[model samples]
Target: MTVTPDIVLVLCVLLVVIILFIIDRVRVDVVGIIVMVGLPLLGLVTPQQAVSGLSSNAVVSIIAVIIIGAGLDRTGVMNRLARLILRFAGKRESRITAMVSGTVAVISGFMQNIGAAALFMPAARRIASQTGIPVAHILLPMAYCAIIGGTLTLVGSSPLILLNDLLVVQGKSYEHFGMFSMTPIGIMLIIAALIYFYLLGKKILPGCKQIRERGPLSPLLDKTYHEVGKIYEMVIPENGFTKKSLGQLRIRANYACTVLAAYNHVTHKRIVAPLSEDELSPGDCLAVVGPPMFVEKLARDFGWIYKDELKVFADDLAPANAGIMEGIVTPRSALIGKRVGDFQFRRKYGVSPLAIFMGHEITVSDLSVQTVSEGNALLLHGKWSAFHRLKDQNDLVFTEPIRGEEIREDKATAALTCLAISLFMILVLNIQLSIALFFGALCMVLSGVLSIDEAYLSVDWMTVFLLAGLIPLGLAFENTGAAKLIADSLMHMLGVPSPIVLLASIALLTSFFTLFTSNVGATVLLVPLSMNLALSCGCDPRAAAMTVALAASNTFVLPTHQVNALIMRPAGLRPIDYLKAGAGMTIIFLIVLVAGMRIFF
Candidate 1:
């Protein structure tokens, strides 16, 4: 009858979490928040520990990661990269499937799998759209590929990396995994996944009734076009745009309008999503997008081509409206043969081209010499007003309204630059992961690829809250002896006199626990028990410890595992699908793990 106060608190928290997860009524973030704040209120952890997740370095890095991802996507960096890799995929469906999985795995092997997925998922979707390949066939494989990739290096997966550090802290340094020690097994799993997906998964990938044609971005871009900003074709007379570098103009800074592109007869140059260094010139015809007020002020200040408020069209000229519009540059149009830089398009026309499809390829690096091709497609970006104005002109072809056209060549450069610097710090300088990401995000914002406000908004608050709220519960479990209790119960029930069984049991249990919680959390709770079990069973504690670390990644089923969840919905897969697809991979991984142990130990 004399239950410890700690037990009551721990048990109460567990019961509450299970109930909340089952009901699924309250949001997951809310559930985490309750556990975070409730534990301390019930006298389990200190108030500091309860709110610790909010201040954790991991939380900040995660936020930075999301912002970094947004910068990459918004700037078309990922798109450009995806296009390059996908080009080699070939036309064969099987080849495409194999190539996509292989590329994602290689990228994921070096970076966080989630970030790698974010970079390539769109390309997979785009490939599906362009080639008539089923998205369902590729999305799930993409997720699995990334998961498998993480097993390759020391830092590939957090749990694996963190497990070593945790062991060192516990004074079990002798029994640790080296940086590339995981390569053998990790490669085995990755190869197995690739082969399986190509031979079996690709062939059987469902028609997925859930796949929306063109994937999620097209429709999102469609809806967001009219929902975000006003696009205007504003003229920039001598004083307004001439002689100031777009960076100096700080149009986005001072005027809040992006100079999508520009052309001027004065310079015979055109600017396409010109970087900050590209300057403006007199008589520049600029295309810009901004708030209605900024657009109007800009026009009044410059006296460029602008809509007369009284003489409007079908859609309102109010700045509140936003959408994607396209226009063709005609031979008669003054913009013809102009260097993009001459007009400060953003400063004049008030719109930018998302893509410039032409018969001849214009290397992006050759932007300086690139002229406006006479018969090319200019995927213009800006307000509905800009499109309307472009339409009335004698020179260009205007296409139907489109959405999601905010790609920037300059921003893409910024993303690449940021990623490059971060990678250097991480791989060359050996900087901590969180610090590397934080610094990279700062560089992204400062470089003008990602603005501060955009970075803040880019964060997925739900995931943040969930991370912040649930992290402290790990402390509660340890403090309350729940970890010990579980270890003892397992030892008595399944911990036979044999070391091999003990090792297998520990590894299996750790993998099972990761299905629901994070591998990091699972590792933290299981490390103590696993280490104790190893010693008591007379097992090589190092072998047993590493087994647990490897098992943490065996989080095969359950969308609850974020890695599995990454492409879950987009892949049009349900929980049952994950169980079916992942089970094979999990079994393959564990089998290799055991074999590797026997062979290496």
Candidate 2:
């Protein structure tokens, strides 16, 4: 194949994309947008072809899958799954690892792997706290399984979903893969990962002695605030205490105690950071944080029953549900140049201040009237839901990882029904994958499983645009003969190798490439070339394309994959930890992948 000017231009663009991705300074999405516009300007692809990726089936399917996952999450499906896993797992560390990691792998077979990993993170931490197991042992296996789980279905991951679309673009002879076309391979891989972790995990995985103590309140806070960060539960006296607002009682002003959460027995509702004017009724339970002596004194004076353990609000106040976060006052914050109480910090934001760290001084007393300034770091205590809402605002720049959302248990059945219908459409009706998935997402919005706004927020636009923008680049590679040229050069370099050797080479190359760039990027760049290489060697081009997509998920040797990065800091994992554990996983994945392709396809 002759390399034309267009091929040179495409190669140049491909090289720039690789370098920009490696440097990691520019946002990956921005790199995508640059390609989207740059290609049309350079005359390699027509303007229409450049914009066509946005309307591609792969992009639409990803958006729909994300929305459906969000609807499930909003309605408490994942939470219920977590509870069931814990119930069956018991206190056995090995059982907990297998159960949790296996479940996440199955969940990830349909939705984005990162989302599945993230949804299970708090649950993993909770398990560690309860079982005295270091989180590192659980997280590495879970992350690896989540990545490999993408091979379970066509829509399980972006690379797999894009495979059929890329094949369709390759020409009409290549047919699309069914939803479960890759199921056998995915199951084998997941089982291999589970068994690997079960036998060798304790020896290979990193150890964090402080992981158990690093619950929601965190060991850092316990060391920094000492008694002030100690949490206690209090019950209002049934007959002696009258219905009085918190402000009237001056709980913070007099006793320096902050009510972090309140549970109303009458309404059966839980409120976090209740306003000062919110009345405290008899027999209500309060989750408070303060100095031990002061809390004890306040409890004695009010004839309240106080317990050191958070038994009543234990689940609700667990690290997974609620926790303390540090928020720095931004220069643009409305709280700047005013006292903390001026905005009714607790009432408006649903968060109560625990301490203020300004410069080198830390103050925990009289926080309500404390003057806020730019760069002042305020330690706030509240539910994770409140922090999730505040994360979008510019008032405070949260320094900690914020996760978890409030669940709508009432809509769980509706969400499950939508998912079931979507599956039925795909399996029974033989409808288009994009149309069927989007139909389910629409049903979710209509059924109140998720609001329209929530559905929109659920999508990771970065992943969508990255896949969409790169589609045309793949098209250009084929159009300009760039892919065929590279294929010829590779074949010439190997001097007409056998089909199996060629396949292994292709898989290994794709796996290595994915470690640096996004898996989506690796898939788009390699599929066309691999298909061309396969055709030249008289091998099945579809099998070669499948190898590219599957191999892209074999990114275990590094923490570049989104799932690995998400669990790294929380699990206290280092690069060496990944290297030691992932080395074995990567090898196992390749062996299973090559053998499965030869056997199944």
Candidate 3:
């Protein structure tokens, strides 16, 4: 039989989506928009039909959730929580891993997983530096916990939103999922994950030995620039420096470093305004910034011994060790199209490229071998000595130094306020209003809880636009009648009289597609087909639709399926890590989903 024009059009569109996803050529959102508009031009869908998916409740809910997440990130509340957790973690690696992962999972249950991960990352890095623990030991668990936590709530992740929309469209009218619908399963998964980490996470993860040997600040300490500048951490020893008048020492002329700030060690209040010459005292911490040479000379002249061995300035010095250098592959970064092994990074820059924050998640086994795309954040590592030299080179864009205090302080009240707004929108108002979530996020910015620039920085606009663009394409599948055709074929092949078998088939296929393509895209494509299949089998279409929708989000086998993959790279992970950790979870989720659909739907 000759295939219809609609089938041919859908096949072509599917091919494009798959190819674009694999090649990382255009942004996925752009690709999605093209398919949505292009299919209509080909007479496969009407303009109205193509635009309908944009109105999907799922899409609206997701946008709101993202905005709400941005608000929480702005408040710096999460950072405070991380610090408190780290303080209580002690020195036991396994206990630390459990605590960090557990806390991340719990918080992510109510907020966005990526938001939680971003908030916790700096603290994790700090703990790693202070305790001489390799970041690898904690980061993977951190990412995994976020993923598991997101599975708990309807507002936690996009897949849950998609599932609810699919059910509504199928006439089941499942407006909301219970807060704890997935908690039992999620909690079980966490317990299992903790056990696995205890058994194998330590052995496979990198150790703290390298960090200890290098010293806490060794990576950032510019050994080559002897005395060019001095970063002194003077406790108000005898209050002499504090008591000395600014004019007496001529700090600006003598130190050559700007007096960045002064904090009264006793009061902990920062002295931002100009200090009166007579206000000098003995008990304050002087945060001075100036030429290394001048500071070094002054320190010697003043009997200030350089205590490089002390951890007093540990927080301030940690970023230097974890050098943040931004480099565009000028079609020649010694990294383009090369794997990690090819460059032998430790021998070259004395650091590893931790994470590549990109506009899209694409695979690259070797950094040197993979073709570099524009706008990718290559998180590089190196000794401060080598990084300074690298920073001077024209090939890489060196990021401005980020203050440790700014990062730590950024984690305050925003998360709580955002949560309050989200809860009000979902539970109290009962309006199903996504704009409320956005408004709540906006409140954070308007109230000075978070600065405008900081709020903007917190958003993953690429992902947002990608979703916006892809939603339209779902219409093409429906308008073209391609969905009906696929549904017929599926029913003929596997649609037995039993609804359970049919649901399983749809769920399994949806899960497979999700592993490779965007989960939202996977859902938009499969939901219509599964709905039709359910009708053909004389079963509730909502159940089948829910199966497909839920399955799309359960990508635990590979990093490619979810945002968790992007977070994994900085933790120094390999593909096998997902294969081991995510595989069992994927299986458990599938079992639970299938059973839940049978009983609930």
Using lDDT, give the best candidate's number: 2
What TM-score would each prediction reach against the true structure? 0.63, 0.58, 0.55
Q: Residue 451 in candidate 1 has what lDDT?
A: 76
Candidate structures ordered by TM-score, highest first: 1, 2, 3
Enumerate clash totals for all models, in the order shown.
Answer: 32, 0, 34
Q: Which stretches of candidate 3 lie over 4 Å from their true place?
A: 1-3, 25-75, 88-101, 107-183, 190-224, 227-317, 320-415, 431-433, 495-506, 510-552, 556-601
Q: Which runs of model 2 end up more than 4 angstroms from their true locations?
A: 86-100, 107-147, 150-188, 192-229, 232-314, 323-406, 492-503, 509-588, 595-601
Give the clashing pairs for model 2: none
Task: Name the 10 consecutive residues with the lowest summed lDDT in model 1.
Answer: 310-319
Residue range 115-207, candidate 3, lDDT tens digits: 566557656755765556777787877777777676666666666666655655444554445656655555655676677678877564544
RMSD of each: 14.5, 9.4, 14.3
C-alpha-based local distance difference test score of model 1: 0.65
Give candidate 2's TM-score. 0.58
| Candidate 1 TM-score, C-alpha based | 0.63
* lDDT comparing candidate 2 with the true structure: 0.79
Give per-residue CA lDDT, model 1, range 1-601, as digits (tens).
1347786778777777756655557766787788887989888889999898887765666666667777787776655554565557654667777788778888877887766765576667656654556676777777777877887887887777776766643554665677888788777777877887777774346545433323111343445333224445555566544477766765554565555555665766654445666766766666565567776776676566664221111112212123455456777776678865574555565665444446744222233345776776554555544555556665677655433444466667768889788878877898876788889989989999877988888776766776677667767776777655666677678654576677668777877666544578777777766776677767776677677777777865545555454455456665556666777777777777777666676
> Which scores better on lDDT, 1 or 3?
1
Relative to the true structure, candidate 3 reaches a TM of 0.55
Order of candidates by lDDT, top first?
Answer: 2, 1, 3
